[model samples]
Target chain A: MRQSKLVGTLAVLPSFVIVAGFMAFPVMFAFYISFTKTNGLTYDWRGLDNYIAIFSDPIVHQVFLNNFKFLISVPLVIFSALVCSILLFEQFKGWKFFRVIFFLPNVLSVAVIGLIFRNAFGYDGAVNQFLGLFGNEPMQFFIDSNYSILIIILALVWSGFGYQSLLLLAGLTSINPAVFEAAAIDGAGWWRRLWSITLPNIRKVLGFVFIINILYTFASLFGFVFVITAGGPGYETTTIDFLVYLRAFSSNNLGSGAALAVLLFFFIGLLTLLQNRVFKLQKDD
Target chain B: MSDSISSRLTPRAKWPIFIGMCLVAATIIYPLFFVVVTSLRSNVDYKRDPFGLPVDWTVTNYIELWDEYGVGRAFLNSLFVSTSAVAVILILATLAGYALAKLPVFGSKFFTATFVSVMLLPGPVLIIPIYLVLARLGIVGDYSGLILVYVATGLPFAIFFLTLTFRAIPDELLEAARVDGAGFFRTLWSIVGPMGASGIATLAVLQFLGTWNELIFALILVPDAQMRLLTPTLATIGKRFVSDQPLTSAGLFISALVPLLLLTFASKYIMRGLQVGLSR
Candidate 1:
């Protein structure tokens, strides 16, 4: 028994070691370095000075605000996904082709998504060129805070809606047929059935989509911003992750960077806790 | 009687919805199509007519990108990192998932908790620390360093997927193997491994795709231009050479090629995985 347990333990140990070394230990190490001044070369104890400076800085405030503005993409993306999924669920003529084409954005690298959007919206790029024929002057995107962030949100919507609609479509498929039949026989029209029967049946899947996309809005917007704006035209469009990267590497201010990373960690942790609570509440019903 | 909810839609609803979907699909497809077309054209040709068929369609941009910008090398680097990490993850997750699903591994409870927490740790939080860990270990900017992060980060999902997968295999089989004087490891490799082949393959493919599409970690750890992976390299080009649409498009096309293919061909498995993920 002991030897069997030993073998089992040995088999499972490598994963733990890698996680502890790369993930677990560094989490605490990040906390430690957050309080100190360090850039992989120099380490000096600062004792909350880093946090103090970051809190007082207006750029950090703007980054946080930028992250909040980006949160607006969450509902926008879910709505878009819902619309697409609902349409695709109809299995209309050429639905298969539409479904495949729709999901194309999700599979490509975010860098590729960013490039497509940037080039399409660049001053001399396709969108402007098309607009130019309508007698409008050239307009620039991905160059400033508001315009670039708006473009980023549009990019997010374009990329995520199809993939998520697939998830919702799967949700719609798995739903029992009898419920839809009952709703239809009772004189519910298509839109009425969608609202009453289809939407109600997919609460859990909808919840799942809602949860992941919310988290994605917080943690996963980096690649989009990095390629499209590079957090540029100053610190205006910089979300938290890009700002953290910039502070840690580009700005040569490692302590504050570590501090920013740790702060964002706590913020996300709190958000996750809150999200889980809401989800659990919904599940209880 | 309930063939589809579509049965309820009047012709009016169906026509408008179909047209709307067609417009949406056209919007999504045209930009990617434009990029591919632009990639084939020279800068001069693209400038001459951005929307037209490539007047002087040439693969010169691709050939030049390969020779000059090291994008080809980066593609190889991306492949090596993604594959290497997936290989390690498969091995570790298979053994560990099997143990958790069947074997009475000591401290299994603790291991499960740790993995769950680590899996939930946000990427922004992990980036600095993971990089610092690699830097501390003197492995930053190395392929091994990036591979290590991928394996570590990827394990939770792979193990979670496989644990559920391995559960469907009956305990009677394991007991039977044990009675045959087969040790636990031997049974795992022979009986469990083959039986769980489908799940293992799914795990491998998903992990490979996820790692291949990763950006920030590779961008930060492997900052050396020659060592950069495909997405990161493409980003550098997109940012630094925004004016050179032809060159940038060629790199974007290369970065997109494999993933686009996988998403097209293997979408069945991937969608099934997504369904499973949601159910979890």
Candidate 2:
């Protein structure tokens, strides 16, 4: 029995090693480094100083605010996807074709999407050229902070709505048709059925989608921002992830970078806790 | 009764919804169309008619991207990184997934939960420490360093998927294999591996496409010109040569070609995987 257990352990040791070294260790190490100050070359333990420095900085405050502002897209994306999924659920003509078309962007590298959008929005590019016909000047899409944020969200929505809708569509498909039939037979309007039946039935997936949207907007926007804005126009468009990269790699300020990362990790952990609560509530019902 | 109601509602609802979906699809396809058309146009033609059909179509931009910008070398680099990462992830995750699913390993449940939670680690949040760790190990900017990060990031989803797949296989098969005196590894390779072929294929395709298109880690970790992957290379071009629409467009298409094909063909498997992975 011990030998068999040893074999089982051995089977998993490689993955365990990789995860521990790359993921687990770095997380804890990052937390420790966050409290220290370094010039990217060396470090000194100054407990809470890095955290204090970051929170006090107005630019860091703006990055956090921008991140939370990006969260507004959460409900917007979910609602749009929910509506689209409901439409697709009707098995409309070419529904599969539409689904495939929508999901195409999600599959392509975010880097590619970012590049395409960057070019499309570049000065004298297609978007500008189109605007020029209306007598508008060529705009610096990445230079303006508000404009950059809008562009970032546009890219996110363009690439992700199809995939999110597909997830919701899967959730919709899992509902028992008889339940819908019962609702229909009881004289519930379409809106009534959707509000009470469809929404409740997909509560768990909706929660998951919301959590994923937060995580995505928080961390996964790195590639897009890196290519599109590069956290440019003097950090006006910087989200936390891009800011962290800027501090760490570009500026060689590891301590402050790690501090911001720790905060981001805690933010994600809170979301995870909320998700678990939702899961429990879902299971309870 | 339900059929009749839906049928009655169809006329008013269906056409508007169809048109809306068509508009959405058009929006989704527009940028991609722009990329392809602009890639085909010469610089002079692009300047004249940025939004309209390319009047002077040319493959010169692609040739230049490949020959001058060394996109071919970057493509090979991306291919090597993605394939290597997939290979590493598949072997390790399959073994781990099988153990957690079938083997009577104590703490397997704990490990499974830990693995799932790894997805929530917010990847960019760890860039600082990971960079430090890799630099400490003297592997920063190396192919192996980037590949390791790719393998680690891709591991959790692959393991979760494979664990679910492995669980669906019957216990009797493993018992029968053990009866034949096949050892653990041997049984896995012979019985489990073949049985889990579809799961393995899904994992491979997903991981390959993911690592192929991954840019953040590649951008930061592999900064060397010779080591830069396709996505980062494309990004550099997009940033450095923003004025060269034809070249940038061609670079974008080339960067997207492989994964776009996979997304087009194996879309069903990918979506199913997303459903299972997300809804869990």
Candidate 3:
């Protein structure tokens, strides 16, 4: 037993070293940096000024609102993913082809997708031309600040739905067919079966996917906003991550950026904790 | 009764949903298709009808990208970085996973939990800190710096999946190897390694995809035009040369082709890896 214990310690040591040296240290260092007036290269302690400035900055407030917009869209995306997964889960001839097509966008880099859509939605672009067929004028997707966030949200949903569908499909497939057969025998209709049988069985996976999709979407809003719009048209779509980047790189306010990072960490952490509670509740039920 | 209910759902209901799905699919597929079509068209033809299918199919965009823009070099740079990063991730994750799974190490549970916690942290949160560290190490603008960061970022989830797979391996196999007088390394190499091939391959493909598709770190860390990865290069092309539609589309399509082909070939493994990586 002692020998096994020693072996286990030895086995896990490399991972421990790497994680500690890289991940843990950086995280703690970042937290520490939040309190200083560092310009990323130089470290000078500045107490609560960074945190205070962040709370007072108008752009920071805009970023918070943008993040809230992103957070609000999560449930809508999840619902769409759930509904589509159910629709696609049934046995059909072209199911695999549809699956491949749906999943195509997920594999491509978000940067490329941003570029493709940016051009596609430009004033003289295809989307406008297509809308011209219906007598509507071309709408500025990338340039118009009012519509920029919506475009990002749409692109995110389009790129993401496939993976969620796949997860739900896998969860659906794992349910014993006999249970469904029994449901059918008992005269449980399609909706009834979906609610009472399928939904209940896949709830755990649903909760997992929900938490992941929300967290990932929250984190990734910055990337899309960066690549597609660059928080353009007067910082309309500037998310917390974008703000952090601006603070650190553009404004040379590393302290403020670190404070923003800490706030983002807590917001995401709280959401994740709620998600875990939901998962635990489902497991218990 | 169930069949009747499903069937009796109004034809209008079915039609609207079907049409909606088709519209969504068309919207998603249109940009990708436009890129391919525009890439094949001459500049004049592209400007005339960027949405239309190419009237004259030509490899000029691809040829020009190679000859003029040096996208081929960018492609090679991305491939090298992604491959090296994936290789390191797989080796380190495997060894670490084996240790975590098989050994009764001190604070093993704590270490595993810590790794999981790090994985949940947003990538942007780590950027400034990591950037500072890389600068200090004199690797801020270096390819190795980017690869190291990718490997580190990817290791947590890779380790997580591999640990699960390793744990699933029957303990009796290890006991049998020990009975044959094989030591720990010998048992791990000879016994556990072969059995975990699928899991290893799955993790490798995932790490490859993640590192290959990553753009943010590549953009920030490697500002030199020559060393930029495919994603950043494509972004730059779009941002800087918006007028060069055909060439930019060609570049975008070229960047996407490899991942598309890989997914087509290893869809099963990718799916399994994603399920395990995300679900657990």
Chain B vs. true chain B: TM-score per candidate: 0.91, 0.93, 0.89
Model 1 lDDT per residue over B7-110, tens place: 45665678999989988888888888898999998888877768889867799999998999898898998998898999999999998898888877899999
Tens-place lDDT per residue, model 1, A1-285, is 888788878888998899888888888888988998887777899999999999999999988888889888889988988999888877777887787787778778888898888887876677876887789988866555788889899898889988889888988887777777777788777778888888987777677788778778777888988988888778777888888888878766677888988988887787777767756755533
Candidate 2 lDDT over B3-26, as tens digits, reads 453422466677998998999889
Predicted complex 3: CAPRI docking category: medium
Best by lDDT: 2
Candidate of highest DockQ: 2
Q: lDDT of all the models against the reference?
A: 0.83, 0.85, 0.79
Q: After superposition, how far is residue B268 of candidate 2 from its true place, in Å?
A: 2.8
- Candidate 3: residue A64 lDDT (0-100): 76
Candidates in descending TM-score order: 2, 1, 3
Model 3, span A63-182: residue lDDT tens: 777777776567767787788777766644356666767777888888888878777776656677778778997776767776887888777887888778878888787777778777
lDDT of 3 by residue, B1-280 (tens): 1333332234454665566666767867877887888778787887676666777888898998777776888899999999999988887887788888887677777988888888877877888888888889999889989988887788889889999999999989888888899987788788888999989988887788788889888988998987778888888777776666777788889989988888889887887786785555
Index of the highest-TM-score prediction: 2
Q: Name the runs in model 3 displaced over 4 angstroms.
A: A1-4, A133-139, A282-285, B1-27
Give the i-RMS of model 1 in Å.
2.1
